[model samples]
Target: MRMDEQFILRVPPSVAERINRLLSENASSSEDKSLDLEFSEDGRTGTFVIGNDRFPASVLDLPCVVESYKTYDDSALVKTADVGQMILVRESGEASPDVVEYRHGLTPPLRDARKRRFRREPDLNPELVQRDAGDENARNANKKAPPAAAAKPEVPDTGGNAGEPDGSDSDDSDDSM
Candidate 1:
């Protein structure tokens, strides 16, 4: 955070505002949000707290040693964030980098991997076909004979009294042999 040295940074106004709000809770006197940040020669950084605790931030810059043309993807931070207004320091690093909201969201666009999907054949199972054939033969053999009618389900009789007439214990007291 010195005057000359460059550094990486990620302090957009929105983020700074949030930090300012967090630091303003117990300001003894006023609700002020002014800040003065400074860094030491030994890389020790400090900030002057004014009305609140929030202060501006900037990151060290990263060196672009290995460079290449990204024919596939755009610059990593083209439109991911509203970072155009964020502070930048001489320390080499991108400021207010936009991180992906969800790691699995929006998979990088893919090429036509399977252009011949229409030409693909339907999946077949020889074992299933054999089982179907067996079922068909069984049905044909059973076609010669008719199935018997099913018996009706028995219903329990409930009389007005507690002891009801059960088939196992008949109430035919009048038919004494």
Candidate 2:
């Protein structure tokens, strides 16, 4: 719950270290602990204890978290900024008493996005959902399968020149001999 404690953001160890370094470098003389990380879910936020106490907490506004995020991005954890991967930045609630106090022992679902597949239910109308059966056949039919290429005649090897015209019967052969 302090500015110095902001370095405790749950991140990869390597990233965390880098973040800590950055935070220390950017540290101000006076510490501020007004910001915190708060997590929440409509009906699915709970804690599991191995052998420690759990308590609700708020989100932290920390430089380490931001720096850690940068490190992860630089490391290409999600792949890329566009196309192959994406990073989802979201705010659960405004900073204040209205913030959801998630349990400490609980593993909050960070960057929880809906499943990509089946994002929207199929249309109710059968006709609208109907797929063209003959479409594939028609497409195949329309595409004229290219004609098989004519086989090239193999040139006879006379030992003179493979592609040169055969003039064995000419005076040239007699001259060579």
Per-candidate TM equals 0.21, 0.23
Tell me, by lDDT, which candidate is best: 1
What would you estimate as the lDDT of candidate 2?
Answer: 0.37
> For residues 108-133, could you state the per-residue lDDT of candidate 1 as single tens digits?
33122223222446677999989999
Best by TM-score: 2
Residue 63 Cα positional deviation in candidate 1, in Å, after optimal superposition: 3.0
- Per-candidate Cα lDDT values, in order, are 0.42, 0.37
Across residues 112-173, which tens digit of lDDT does each residue of candidate 2 receive? 22232225555576654454545766788899889999999998766767677656776757
After superposition, the stretches of candidate 1 with alpha carbons farther than 4 Å from their true spots are 1-9, 12-15, 18-30, 48-50, 54-59, 65-177
Worst 10 residues of 1 by lDDT: 99-108
Which whole-number lDDT from 0 to 100 does residue 10 have in model 2? Answer: 40
